[model samples]
Target: MKLQQLSLFLENRPGRLGAPLEAIAAEGINILTLSLADTAQFGILRLIVREWDKAKQVLEDAGWVVNLTEVVAVDLLDRPGGLAEALKILEAANLNIEYMYAFSLRRGDKAILIFRFEDPDRAIQVLLDNGLHVVDGDELMSFVP
Candidate 1:
């Protein structure tokens, strides 16, 4: 299972972030999850939305640098060591996690962790074999907050 994450390159200016959000809103795309990783001069806005393709086109049409990446969204318990348990499974498989972010899913008891790994397919298979539930783009988008 994989979700399409939109990576939008934004300059470190006041309205830089607003433009992308505005574009998404204008396109009527519902953002399920978002995180902004910033640097001194720029930032990368990663987003999971209701309509991946439409959101991407809307951003590109507005002249923003956008890219789509497949990220694995694993169901985790919303408590201590929940993430550790998941990582342990990945570590056992020798899969390296490049980056990851967490958010509460529509189902309150579970958390959604989006991970970018060295090998996504391998990671997915490993998690699946271990009985870790992975959600796809559509399912992830349906998650609240």
Candidate 2:
């Protein structure tokens, strides 16, 4: 199970982030979840949109350095230790998590976790065997914000 995450290289300048947002908005693609990892000069804006392929194309045509990455999406209980329990499973399976971010849907009992792991296939199987629910890009996008 995987979702397409758009990673755009953003300069630390005014309106740099706005362009991408506007592009996606213009195409009627709703952003489900987003996170920004920044430094002094630039940052990476990771976005999960309702339409992955369209969003990617829109961003690229607009001259943005956008890339599509397959990330794991897990449904976790909205409670304490829910994340810990999932991490424990990944850790025990020797999966290295490169990055992760999560968000709660407007009407749901579970939170969606987006993860980039060292070994995606193996990690997916491990999570599945361990009883964790894994969702794909289409399924995950269906829960639009």
Candidate 3:
């Protein structure tokens, strides 16, 4: 299971983040989740939205460069050592994690985590083989609670 994420490069300055967000908001696109990481010069804004294509168009039309990247959404127990167990499995499979972010919604003691792996296909297979649940895009976006 995989999801498409929109990434935008933003300059490290005040109000730079508001422009693209306002544009997306103007189009009535709701962001499911987002992660913002910054360095000295620039920041990378990663967003997961139900209307990804529309959101990308809105940003691009606003004179911003948008990149689409594939990431995996995983269903993990909201308990101690939950993440560690997953990491251990991945480590055993020799998979590399590029980055990760989490959605705040807790669905019945389950937490959804977004992971960027070097090889997503293999990682998904490995996780499934270990009896882990990998969430599909539709399932992730359709979660009510």
Candidate 4:
């Protein structure tokens, strides 16, 4: 399964990040997980939210350049080495994970990892073939606050 992720540019300065976040919040969208990587001039914000289109609309309307992409959400045990185990499976399948971030529901002993792969659909197929539980957008929104 795959979920849509939103990526946008944020100037590397205080308060630049707050504008987009505030836009999403004003629309009542919940950010499930996010990762920010910065360079000298700007930063890239990768976010998975409860509602993708609405979130993107808000950011773009507010003058932020927003892009929508596909990402895989894999289910993993919430324990030591759990991630390593999942990586091992992808490794054996010759899948490369470009990047990943994680989040957990309020009451589950499980972690949900959002992955960016060279081939998103293929990665999901490989994870499924290897007995890994690949989660979908609706499933992820199940625990939204």
Model 2: clashing residue pairs? none
lDDT of 2 by residue, 1-145 (tens): 7777889999988888898999889998888889888899999999987778899999999999888887898888889999999999999989999999875463377887889987789989999999999988767666564
Q: Which of the numbered candidates is closest to the native, going by highest lDDT?
A: 3
**How many clashes in candidate 1?**
0
Give lDDT tens digits, candidate 3, residues 1-109: 8899999999999999999999999988988889998999999999999989999998998899999999998989989999999999999999999999997577788
Indicate whether candidate 3 or candidate 4 has the larger lDDT: 3
Candidate 4: what lDDT? 0.85
**How many pairs collide in each candidate, listed in order?**
0, 0, 0, 0
Off by over 4 Å in 3: none
For model 2, the superposed segments whose C-alpha errors exceed 4 Å read 104-107
Best by TM-score: 3
Per-residue accuracy of model 4 over 1-145 as CA lDDT, tens digit each: 6899999998899888888888999998878788897899999999888778989888888898999889998888889998999999899889988888875453377787889999998888888888889888787777667
Q: Give the range of the ten consecutive residues with the poorest summed lDDT in model 1.
A: 136-145
Once fitted onto the true fold, the runs of candidate 1 whose alpha carbons sit more than 4 angstroms away are 104-106, 142-145
The TM-score obtained by model 2 is 0.91
Candidate numbers, best lDDT first, in rank order: 3, 2, 4, 1
- lDDT assessment of candidate 2: 0.86
The 10 consecutive residues of candidate 4 with the worst lDDT sum are: 101-110
What TM-score does each of the candidates earn? 0.92, 0.91, 0.97, 0.92
